[model samples]
Target: MEQARRVEADVDSCDPCLSVSHLSLRFGAGCPSCMAPDAALERNVCPVCGTVHAVRDVSFDVYPGEIVGIVGESGSGKSSLMKCIYFDQDASEGDVRALPFDGGAGNILDLSSQHKRRVRNTVFGMVYQNPYLGLRMDFSSLSNIAEQMIASGERRVDAMCERGYELLGEVNIPARRAKDAPALFSGGMQQRVQIAKALSNNPPILLLDEVTTGLDLSVQASVLDLILRIRRDYGVGMVVVSHDLGVIRMLADRTLVMLDGRVVERGLTDQILEDPQHPYTQQLVYSLI
Candidate 1:
């Protein structure tokens, strides 16, 4: 904790696009993972008092133009980290500091309601496993993007609509369908629209949580390819979360392995795949093969 604070205090030499330090979420008095990592994972409840430690002292960084992937089984706390970072769920403890928003040097985890909205619209773009969470099924695709723009204080109707159209096209949606409701679109198209809207604000940081989980293999490929292109063309930083090893292998430059809410191992994606040091990570990699 002291070392993390030292790095956080200076931050002059370490400019991670997004930095998470000792961030945790607990639903009880004490953290179960801190006591017994294996028991906490095997039975999400603490033996002594049944406290749920959904996430325990998780920490990492996302650098500019980097793709950082978090992979673990369900209930491993990867998704919990996502919700915490995006502020959909608050962390019981720790700080989530971000850049390119609020003068670029404040803990987002501690931001007020107003600042939270500001950060969501301006600093972070999130695509959830369910497109519905990120989109309004009843609204036109263009209007959906425009809503984010308006929230961010972009009032010019003409420019906002134009940018919406451009983003839709960039995400591989037909520009002509901008006026159609997302409900009328196919599942894959809806996800593409969600991606389009996520980028409507041109945020520097993007969070993707199992965005390809339910799609057909081909559809998943298209989405993954689009993500690869977005990174190449825009040089944005991304934190991608998925249980699929293939997906992580395809997208992540670096990978973090989670178990019982703790990050057990992390390193270059290829290295983790070829030579996973942690036993849990080895089992996961072998299962994928």
Candidate 2:
């Protein structure tokens, strides 16, 4: 696979738009046995307390205009980490800070529900693996965009309409088709509409979860191209999650490999592809070959 085009941002000079540290998610109360720093579990589940450690101390940062990728097989907790960052799932333990909020000093996870809602509306835009989770299937594509803008406090109807059309057009949705419901569109079109909605609020950080998972190869290419173009034009930082290393190779500057709820390896995307350190990572790279 061709290496992803490098983002032009001076990453070290710019502060991260999003920072996550020691993020953990568990489905049940944990026992001392499974909660220790040296704890080992049967897969990700605690045999003692039956707690599902969906995510374990995962951490990363996304600089402006940078795309950080998380790649892993099913049950690796990459998706769970994304949900925790976006507030869809409550993290059992972690600190997440959006630089635009409180100068990144406060942990957003501890914020009140009202403030969390504000963060979700203004600081982060999330596109889920399932369009149904990100878009209102019965709402017109334009209306979907409007809904997000409205949540972010856009009150001017005219402005929302203009922004909606502009975003839809940017994602290559025809102006005429913008009025149709997403349920009526193809899978790729629905994803494009979901992306438009995610961008409506112009959040600094975008969380994309398996955005091109089930599309045709040609459509996947189009979606990936559109994502790169958006990053180039808007300079938005992004966290892209996918099981497909090819997609990660095509879009990510840096990559994190997760297995059984923990990050097992991380580095420049090209470096990891060329010389993976972890056995799981080696397996992943070899399978791609």
Candidate 3:
């Protein structure tokens, strides 16, 4: 069984807003890679050939107003874990449950395709690393946000536009540019718009995958600040995946460190940085300094 440890910290004592238990995903029938603890594979798979354990027995929880950061290098399966929760990718095993979901503790993975789509729109919001993936570049920013509202079952043009205009302003985008296409916005502005769209439905949980992967330093700071404010003011739970430790430190209340598709360490952000228990974490911390 995978462990979800709540080490020393000031985490909320309330029930978890989202719970992921013993989640494991493997691609391909036969994989032979360095991830095998021994030649005897309990999961009976490796990281080589066609098979890859994108996420291995990973488990964690996020409270109503907490941020959980997953830090790892590219291909370390951090993003995969996020996707599984958001239902972007199906897990090979294990289950995920979220509060406010009608199914209660039922595994969302087993939900029908239509119900899954409903969950994506109403229960969770996802901000992909690429704005292009999250936004409709050809559509105006207002419409981009309105589209989400429509999917979430909102009707009435005036109400949708009102929410759209409000979201644009909330993301720091000038209200005057609400009608402008996303292509006309800078990368930073586009990312801001993406955030606005992600929050349009006011979902309880937000999944941010490498949200600051490509951007100028100043723009990155602005986005990070916006996220901080949202959590501070709105009490939204978030799962943030990033390769940059600094980004994780700034946004996450708790951090999970992964290597080769497995979480080797997890704890309060300060503890992980100051007293890394794993050798890989030690090297990563020193490299940051």
Candidate 4:
């Protein structure tokens, strides 16, 4: 098996918004054993266990304005890797360094709690598997988006309202319906609303975890188109996690394949899909067709 390797560069001489070196995460056995058997899980065994386990030693880089896809079967560590990068969980070992707006390179793993909060709020945006969960079903769409800004401490009411309406329009939600709650909208509409909220702060990077799941074929196509459009228009780097090769073909510039919690193969989208080097990746590609 290939352990994740580090690509080293001069730390003092690189762009700050994104730079990760020798990053690794391990979740101990007690962590998984503590959860109910029915509790949701992504990787097979605990990453932190001393035994030979899944998702071992993975590492990679994401450049500014680039869209990278992590593709694999269920329980392939795709989501786990994303969670680690997004700060949803802590990596037991390794270094994650990101450039903050203040023009300093800060270690993600060692940041002050206050700085970590700022990094999540101001520099990174995340879109989850379910769009409904991203928004408040009880609040109007406008409120859902406005509240995100408010949480970030952008308190000027007029600016928030204006920006909120603009975001709705940007996502093609008409101003008339902007005040409606997500429950009133279709799945596709709800997904768009989620996108608007994710883009609320214009963060440099977007982490999308199966954002198109459970939608009809037509709706999925539309959502994919919107995602591509957003990437082109905003030039934000994206990390897309999906099991579908078709989705990856349509969206990812590069692809990484994970199996049993470890990355089995990786390459440009065309190369990996057309001429996969790893047996697991080959099986996955065949299964997709």
Candidate 5:
């Protein structure tokens, strides 16, 4: 009898425009020889060294309008992977191929810095783990959101401000507070402001790096609900990097489980949660419970 071949998930649903293949990244290589001995050795020496790998050879495709969760413990390389996909960091090896709006083929990694900035400004947006990092402490919430639209070349200050106020209202922040800096708001309110900023340009893909960290349980739940609503309303593809299984269950259609810098499992959210096959995944599920 012939051995059975493992079946892969259908690629039909994956966006033809976004493709990532055999991605890998490592640190310590950038250290100069004069600054550090064994710099060459450090190049290949695992920073995590038999522990975590930061981001091992990983590959995945994200379809337009799909919500994918990248879940792992701290140091599992969830954030690093998102950084690479978002073009914030260069991958040591592999390819991130994307199609331009004009139907030109482009490699995100190979784009010139200027082009990369253009893509980031107009084509992609990100939400940081800390809401304060996304805002200007010296500026009002309305101005913070409008600034992003301006940077992305929206050009008309009046229009940006009008749209900014509309987004603030959309995220449920009161118009009265629009003139206040995010510092004056509670954690949840600040997060709402961050969401408004991230959505200002209507980017097709939104990379959210632990958007609900450090909040109380109720606040976290509310933020997650708001995120889900934004996903439906905007129809944007989202990659949510989080350690919280509850949040993943609420938002992700598919989940990728990372352990010590490697992807240990990938499957539907409920299936993997219920019947995880990898030992590391089992431990993660147990820890969640």
Candidate 6:
């Protein structure tokens, strides 16, 4: 794998908006045999202890105005890592810090539930792979965005409505459909609504998990375009997780390749696409060709 020389130069000056260090998420207790540094497990599962190490020792930083991509096969811990970051699922152990929260001095993973919620509302905006998980299906699209704004402590209805309409249009959701429930919208529209809701609070960082997985190619393109537009317009740092390298190539400034609960390769997107280090990463890149 040819490592890009430019990555170090590009990140030398700016402080990271989000930093994750030695993050790990596991299910069930681990035995010494499977817990060793040299332990070999079946994929991510401990054969002896029946424990699933969904993510292990993953670390990364997202700088303001940068888009970082995490790519891997299904069950490779990519989505699991995102879930852990957003507190959808608590990580067994890790440290996550955002500059917008506590001057980046506190480990958000260890914060109280109340403080964590505050981080979710004010500092990080999350879009899940499944629209059902990210949006209120029974609520109006406008109401969905307002819900997020309200969580962020916005009390002015007129202000929330203005923001909601602005975001909906930004994501290409028509104002005419603003009052319609997401249950009545198509998958792509629902996803647009979710994106609109995620941006309702003007968060400093966005966590997007497989936002285009099941959409049609054209719809995926539109969603991808919307993401780029959002980044350009809002200048928010983003962590985007996907199984597709093509998507990463289209959007990520930096890319991380994961396999069996660990990051196997990381570099500038072009560097990884041009020269993948790990065998799994090679397979993924070559498949795209």
lDDT of 3 by residue, 13-79 (tens): 6777788988987787654453454433433345245466788889998888789999999888898
Query: How much is 191 displaced in model 3, in angstroms?
Result: 0.8
Using lDDT as the yardstick, the better of models 2 and 5 is: 2
lDDT of each: 0.87, 0.92, 0.85, 0.75, 0.76, 0.91
Give the TM-score comparing model 5 with the true structure, all chains together: 0.85
TM-score of each: 0.91, 0.97, 0.91, 0.83, 0.85, 0.96
- Which pairs, if any, clash in model 6? none
- Which stretch of 10 consecutive residues in model 3 shows the poorest summed lDDT? 1-10
Give the local distance difference test score of model 2.
Answer: 0.92
Q: Report model 6's TM-score to 2 decimal places.
A: 0.96
Q: Please provide, for model 4 over 1-289, each residue's C-alpha lDDT reduced to its tens digit, 9 standing for 90 to 100.
A: 0111111122123454565554545455545542333333444553343332334567666666567788988767678777777777776555665554454455676877787777777788888888765789879988988888887889998888899899999888999999999899988899889899989999888889998889899999988999999988997878899998889988887788888666778877777777888998888778867
- lDDT for model 1 comes to 0.87
Candidates sorted on lDDT, descending: 2, 6, 1, 3, 5, 4
Query: Taking the tens digit of each residue's C-alpha lDDT, what string does model 5 give over 1-289?
Result: 0100111233354544456777777664443431232222322344333222357677876666667889988878888988887777787777776553323366688788887877777677788898766788779998998888888888887898899889999999989999999988998898889889988988877789998889999999889988889877887777899998778878887789987566889987778888999988788788778
Output the lDDT of residue 5, model 1: 39
RMSD of each: 5.2, 1.8, 4.2, 6.5, 6.0, 2.0
Candidate 2 local lDDT, 154-214, one digit each (tens): 8998999999999999999999998899999999999999889989988889999999999
Task: Give one digit per residue, the lDDT tens place, for model 6 in 1-289.
Answer: 2333444565677899999999999999999977887888999999999999999999999988889999999999999999899998999889999998888898999989999999999999999899999998999999999999999899999999999999988999888999999999989998899989998988999999999999999999999999999998999999999999999999998999999999999988988888888999899988987
**Alpha-carbon runs more than 4 Å astray in model 5:** 1-17, 30-52, 99-104
Clashing residue pairs in all predictions, respectively, total 0, 0, 2, 4, 1, 0
